[model samples]
Target: MTTQRPETERQAPVRVFWAPGCSSCLRTKEFLKKRGIAFVSVNVKDDTGAREQLLALGARSVPIVARGERFVYAQSNADIVGFLGLEETAAEMLPPAVLVERLDRVLHAAARYLKQVPEAELDVVFNDFFAPRALAQHAFRVAEAFVEATETGEDYTYERMMRGTHDVGPGDDILGYGASVIAALDAWWQHCPDRSCSAPLRAYWGVQSRHELLERAAWHSAQHTRQLQSIVEHFGGLPDGPLGERELAGLPLPDSVWMEASADA
Candidate 1:
């Protein structure tokens, strides 16, 4: 006989695929238990069916978190930390207006950091595929797609965003493009403040909502902020930031969705 959770506890669907001796798996379990959140636990090591299920879900690792149909195979406990929704100062706790304002500030800060990069280094490749222009263009595109999804309630696909704009470049107006991106994000949060208001996300990304997008936008720019700092370091330029040493060292990095999107790429 199976026991059912109280209706209130059943509202949010959460599951964990875990294995013994996996610290992250243990942390995820403890995280849910401490928060009074009801969740299904699957021990992939002890249960054959559980292992099969994890593989079927495209997870090769333990400590996979599933919020409804969305799955995050974490490299560290910090990667899935946003799902807690409990931190008082977290973006999820911010009022809609403030949240939108924060995105604008991040965009402006990124533009400022980009401007500090030497003109000659703009064309220098930092990683395998990203440079200053590619990174800025990506942020602009992501904001643009999210804004459209907010307005139309239609799922925005990567293919669709690339169709007409594939050949378009950022030109020499990186800051100007960033302003438009920030404006669109502001409009999105203003019109869609209710955390429950959700539209379909592109299946390729995962099942997601406006709430998830907001969290993503916050983390996304932070990732670029780190990258920009690296670029500054390479160019022997000082990257300015408000974060202190310990806080900067402890910054939580988002799980790279690029790994999951590789098949599509």
Candidate 2:
């Protein structure tokens, strides 16, 4: 006779059979947190029934995510990404072929901005243009929304980003910029090989022109650059030039320019 896995055990990580205070469990928790996926962590030692569940699932190890009859041992970022269907979204949202192409234009523009701004004036410019923490939070929120919408078969709307409702001050410029960058990232993800499931997202973006999207991304980056400058000015000069290489490397650019480049191909 087959042993039945309890209802709670059937839930998810699907069943995070872990030992309490285990280092692996902690790492697994961190990974899930980073991806924004909610999971119930069951400590095998505390929950006696969970051990039976693990045994039935054929997992001798402490850290395992059981899904019904099948189970995945330990926490593998790739496994989690696969189990959660992250690749489909990556393919649909950001095709591997077009990745570098989209990134290049944005980086070039950032490089140019770095050259134009003086070291002493960087801080003031950045603060006046954008708030770093706020922007980072917004990006995180957007990413969470995308992940949720993708998983639940729902459409993630950015009406605030598009309509400029989130703009804090000065003619809704910052909100507009934020919306544009989100749009660009959405576009890149749509074309990616792993994110093909983001077709709905791609279709949603299709309504807007590449030029319009890129303009918003560029504007957003420019504002962010200005904000960085403000930081430098206030702090009495930055140690590393103006913007770090990593920051410049990740700037969002126009898709039209991306499409024309050989790098994406």
Candidate 3:
């Protein structure tokens, strides 16, 4: 059955397809509620037709949200922040430049790591996480999108590559792979004149307001650095040393503060 928004709800139109007991779905609901944006929530399992409609949207995950014609599947904190244009509010929560920078560092490190290890060992690493064909495809997609997005200033086509695939082995390894992808993007960005460090950097902040973009960008970048460390541990095993505590301390503000601010708001 199709669900229509009430007259009041139509004033701030959003439609959220959710499944009960999904944490992401609840988070999406709460995020919208907090922003005072009116939304129509459809429990996909309760309605057969709604489930089909969701499938038609190319969404296979819970907490799929649509605002007018723009839709994002598999709601994430970043996705929600970007969609709602809450960069100003969430700016303190993330370091914007961190994503690109961390991406740069990790990709280079992985490449170096691969060089140090033998082909057989690399094969073992690939085998541990992904099929041979799948690993090659993923690497190629990451490299290609980094080039395309940098050259054209378009959205990275990485999302398209990830479609139809759900189990990315372990979450940690997937994140490490993501770091590698970001690294490729950074390299491409550095070479492309059309791509300013500032533009894609803004994505990390999720800010609609231009005035505070840079500050937010830096914070967003720093946050991703921490996340990348976690991803490394998931894939390559924990670091033998202290794992760069000084780097974290040097960041403008701790993630704790930004998280609290987002939560409080």
**lDDT to native, each model:** 0.56, 0.42, 0.45
198, model 3: CA deviation in Å? 5.3
For residues 96-118, write the lDDT of model 2, one tens digit per residue: 22333433333343334433445
TM-score, every prediction: 0.54, 0.29, 0.41
Positional deviation of 179 in candidate 1, in angstroms?
1.5
Report the C-alpha lDDT of model 1 over 69-128, residue by residue, as the tens digit: 457764333345554444534223344344455556656667777888888767555554
Q: Which residue pairs of candidate 1 clash?
A: none
After superposition on all CA atoms, how large is the RMSD of candidate 1?
9.8
* Highest TM-score scorer: 1
Output candidate 2 Cα RMSD: 18.3
In model 2, what is the error at residue 264, expressed in angstroms?
Answer: 43
Misplaced by over 4 Å in model 3 are 1-51, 56-63, 66-99, 108-144, 152-155, 158-160, 163-187, 198-237, 240-265
Tens-place lDDT per residue, model 3, 48-121, is 69788787767666667776545665324556665655554443422434434533443444333323333343
User: Which portions of model 1 show Cα errors greater than 4 Å?
Assistant: 1-95, 160-172, 191-203, 240-265
